[model samples]
Target: MEKYLPYAVLFLRIALALTILAFVADKMGYLTQAGTAPILWGDWDIYTKQLQAILPFIPGNISEKLAIVATLLEIILALMLLFGVKVRWAAIGTGIYALLVAIVAGYGVGINAILHYSLLVISAASFLLACCPIYKFTLHGIKKRSTYHPY
Candidate 1:
């Protein structure tokens, strides 16, 4: 198990990044058409409506802007995780964002529904990655190894 720690962390990082990017893709209508079942939001308008539904505290006017900001942030965080840039901070950010979403969404959809969505699991995985000392499978790892001076 010890020998696989780095691999596990790498898997976690990639999984989180891909999961986030998938949702971003859905919101952007890169995945499915509107009125599609199972997929959350097909386009920005539907995405904004869903956001408003889940987080009703956000004013209708602000929900659209918030959805845009959330989508952009998710893209940035996903890329950061994928490239292993500041992994700890990125993981922490993802964890916090997921946790907040889970909490709010739980209120809207109930615990069982939120659990099915796996937001809490995502948050936990992100926090788990943040706790790692280093990620040995990242681009930074490769670069550092390539630049090593074995004097």
Candidate 2:
């Protein structure tokens, strides 16, 4: 288990990075149609409407902007995780983002969409665990610092 720790962390990082990159590309209108539409497994319009309904505090334009920001943030977080730079903060941020995605997709949409979100959640969790003190490989593992230290 100890010997494979670094490899495991690398694998999780790669997976999360790829997943987030794909989402960012899709949101940037490079994957499909060129628009500010929300990407959904089913009907985009219906999903957007549901999102608006769920998050009524966000105005229409602001919600679209938020989606784009979220995608960009995911891409950045994924890259940071992959490079093992600020691993602890990046992992925690990604984990929270994954949980939000899971909640929105699972309840707002359908179970099928939840699959990918759940995978993200698991990957984020793995990275988070790898950053923990008990993990065999991490920046923390090398430096042996307390959790309060900002890397």
Candidate 3:
């Protein structure tokens, strides 16, 4: 178990990076649409209609901004996780983001969206596992205190 700790951390970091990188790539039009584009589902007209649908409570403009913010954050979080910087905080943030994605997809897009939500949850779990004390290949590994002690 101790001997393989570094490999485990490396796996987690790479997995999280790949997951988010796929999302970003898809958004940037590198990957073809997997399902119906959320904007075409209704009267919505925007680069990202899923954002508007998921955040009905916010004004359309604000919702668009929020969506952009969320996307940027995810990308940043992915990069941070890949580098193993602040792994504990990144894991917690990833978990919360995954939960939010699940809630939004559940409310706006129905059961089909759950698949994406589940992937996010898995990514979050990976990050959480990487933050464990036994995983010692990360940038945070040098810290004397275990930041992920709660988990």
**lDDT top scorer:** 1
Could you give me the TM-score of model 3 versus the true structure? 0.74
Per-residue C-alpha lDDT of model 1 across residues 23-96, encoded as one tens digit per residue: 89998899889888867778988878878998888899898888888889999999999988878889999999
Candidate 3 clashes between residue pairs 3 or more apart in a chain or in different chains: none
Whole-model Cα lDDT of every candidate shown, in order: 0.85, 0.63, 0.66
**Cα RMSDs, all models:** 3.6, 5.7, 4.9
- The CA root-mean-square deviation of candidate 2, after full C-alpha superposition on the true structure, stands at 5.7
Model 2 worst lDDT window (10 residues): 34-43
Candidate 1: regions farther than 4 A off: 146-151
Ranked by lDDT, the better of candidates 1 and 2 is 1
Which of the two, 1 or 3, has more TM-score? 1
Candidate 2 TM-score to native: 0.65
Candidate 1 global lDDT: 0.85
TM-score of 1: 0.88
Candidate 3 lDDT at 89 equals 72
Q: Model 2 lDDT vs. the true structure? A: 0.63
lDDT (Cα) of model 3: 0.66
